[model samples]
Target chain A: MNNVYLRNSVRFILLILLQVLVLDNINFRGYLNPYIYIMFILLLPFETPDWFILVSSFLVGFGVDLFSNTMGMHTAASVFIGFCRPGVLRFISSTRDYEQGMTPSIRDLGISWFLKYSIIIVLLHHIVFFYLEVFSFHEFFYTFWRVIISTIFTVIFIVIGQYLFYKKK
Target chain B: MRQLFRFLFKYYFFFLFVLLEVFAFIMIANNNYYQGGRMLNTANQLTGSIYQSYNNIFDYFNLKETNRQLAAENALLHAQNENSYVKITNKLFKVQDTTYKQQYQYVDAKVISSSTGKRNNYLMLNKGFEQGVRNDMAVVSPIGIVGIVNGVSNNFCSVMSLLHSEMKITAKIKKNNYLGTVVWEGGSYKTGTLLDIPSHVVISKGDTVITSGHSLDFPEGIPIGTVSYFKINQGDNTYKINITFFTDYKKLDYVYIVRNLFKEEQLKMKGVQHE
Candidate 1:
């Protein structure tokens, strides 16, 4: 239990730093701003309480908002994903249930399962984030394009991070 | 009472989610204004110092580029100095001083953090209220116009960059003095659209766009950009003119916060006129 707490705390701080300090600065043609910090929420332990997940998501999102000056856009998206996480997990787990102490990482689950899980949540999060940031239907198609492109890039970075950090035993 | 307690226990997570979302929505709505809640932005004390320290570490990498830009700007200033010109008109010297009583002042600042990819982009500077940086002051780079200061803390200020979707700059064609508004359409940081100029005004591909001094934010004749291309949408009277911005927002390191000394007086005059 202590180990899990220590590991997650380290991940929280490091991910925020990597996000605001490095990832946010990459211009990538102004449309491919990938957000990998959501990975922190995705990889939480399966048995973590629902309320705890939602609260943690809010804090993580608020941290990103503070550094990037997005105010509440990230917070809304993160809380939405936090609410959706359990449903997404149950839907994906229809074929096989998750065991005790398992996480939603590529190492704990297969690469394919992890990809599906992240893509759904990330798609939902980016939709909320970009739409809120733009805050208008005036440029609907343009904002939608940004959401799609950013989602693709974000998922790619998450997968790369999973492989690089959480090596299989 | 037991039934109510059971129901609350069962649906607690949903209620929590709803509460958090509502709070987030309120923040979003509040942040839409030019002056929103001040505690959450980078201008606040904690984030400002964090960004400043981060900039301290990375600022060394860009020394060469910054030096080149500073040198070029210094050369321009040197050319404009009184020493650069001989006593061509000693008779008009005293009159010139009397006629021009310093309407604008500039405070130099370093950009600690900025973002251009977002639809509403902003830049955070190391100077703030302590440096006389105030809301609505114009920020300009050596190359062209940058933005306006919207939020300020004790030691830091945040600027709404020219790349933001909501930003509007009053501009004029240098050749004919035709006025228009420059706005970003949310894609490229290097270009913006010039609106409200009539199609019959005979615009060329390379005509210079400059600030018209219609507002108190900027001085007249500051270079904005040059016309890249333009067209009329069949039934419209105005040309859809696109101009490439002179300021490369990505490479901005140093900027000048332009304070209009007569701004309060001008605003007071306008207020009186309304009556």
Candidate 2:
């Protein structure tokens, strides 16, 4: 249990540092800002309680918002994604039930399942995030453009990150 | 009651999610100025300390630029000193505890956290109520006026940065001393709007804009920016002037909180009836 705690903390710190120090600074023409930090929520163990998932996701999003200085935007998006993760997991799972203690990753879930899961989660998150940042229907098309571009970029980075770092335990 | 309890228990997670998201949206709406007052601002101790330490670690990378600016300011200050004036004859008559005195004191502080990209931006400084910082005090960077202090906690204070659309700094055209209000419309951080200047002022494009000091927070004649363009508002008989801000809010690090020592005296006049 202590080892599990230590590993989770390491992931939390590394992802937060990378997001704030590197990804936050990447303007990318103000449209394609990839949010790779949502991977933290995607990679949580399958058996983790739903309540735990939502709270943890909100906390991580609040951490990002603290540095970005756009209060509540990230938190609202992240909570929406967190609430929908279980449904996405069930929809994309090969089996009817996810195995206990199973963690979602490229190595553990196979390439196709991982890709589908990551895309769904990242896309839903980006949709909520970009729209919420605007908070109105005033610039519908421009905001939609940002949502689609950021979602694709974020999904691509999450896939790349899974292959680069995931390992069998 | 038992059935209701069971239903809630079965879907407790959904309820929790809805509650948290509602809380987040409320904060966002409040921050966007649907409501006013502090809403989980960085002046909170937890947020303040984290930003303070982060700034400390990252400040080293900007040492070269900071050093260069300091050196230039040092030279300018040196050139302005009066070293040769003979004032020995006035020493005998200089009295202590005379009528009234200087009414403003500046509390130096560092901006531990700041941002310029948002429509309503804010900067968090290291000073707080513990250090004599109070709500509505004027905060200014070395280059120009920043904004008013929004809230102060125990050890930190949050400022309404000039980039915020709601911020309005009273300013004057230094060339002719005509007054106007400085307002930010929020798309570009580089420029702000100066309104209410009469079209008859005949202002030039390069005129300097400085603080009017009508608001007791700031002293008179602090540099704000230079006028970039102006046109008569067809609807109103006022100049719709655009001015480039002198303070680059993105690079802001240090600020001074201007404390009005005579604030109590100034407020006392409001209690009396005017003829």
Best by DockQ: 1
For residues A4-36, what per-residue lDDT tens digits would candidate 2 score against the true structure? 568777887788778865675553543567888
DockQ of each: 0.74, 0.34
Q: What are the candidates' interface root-mean-square deviations?
A: 1.2, 3.4
lDDT of 1 by residue, B43-92 (tens): 78888899899999988999999999999999999999989998877676
Off by over 4 Å in 2: A1-6, A20-36, A62-73, A89-169, B22-41, B83-100, B198-204, B229-240, B270-275
Query: On a 0 to 1 DockQ scale, where is model 1?
Result: 0.74
Q: Estimate each model's TM-score.
A: 0.95, 0.77
Give Cα distance to truth, residue B193, candidate 1, Å.
0.7
In the range B103-176, model 2's lDDT, one tens digit per residue, is 88989899887756444677889998889888888988777899888877888888888876567888899988
TM-score of 1: 0.95
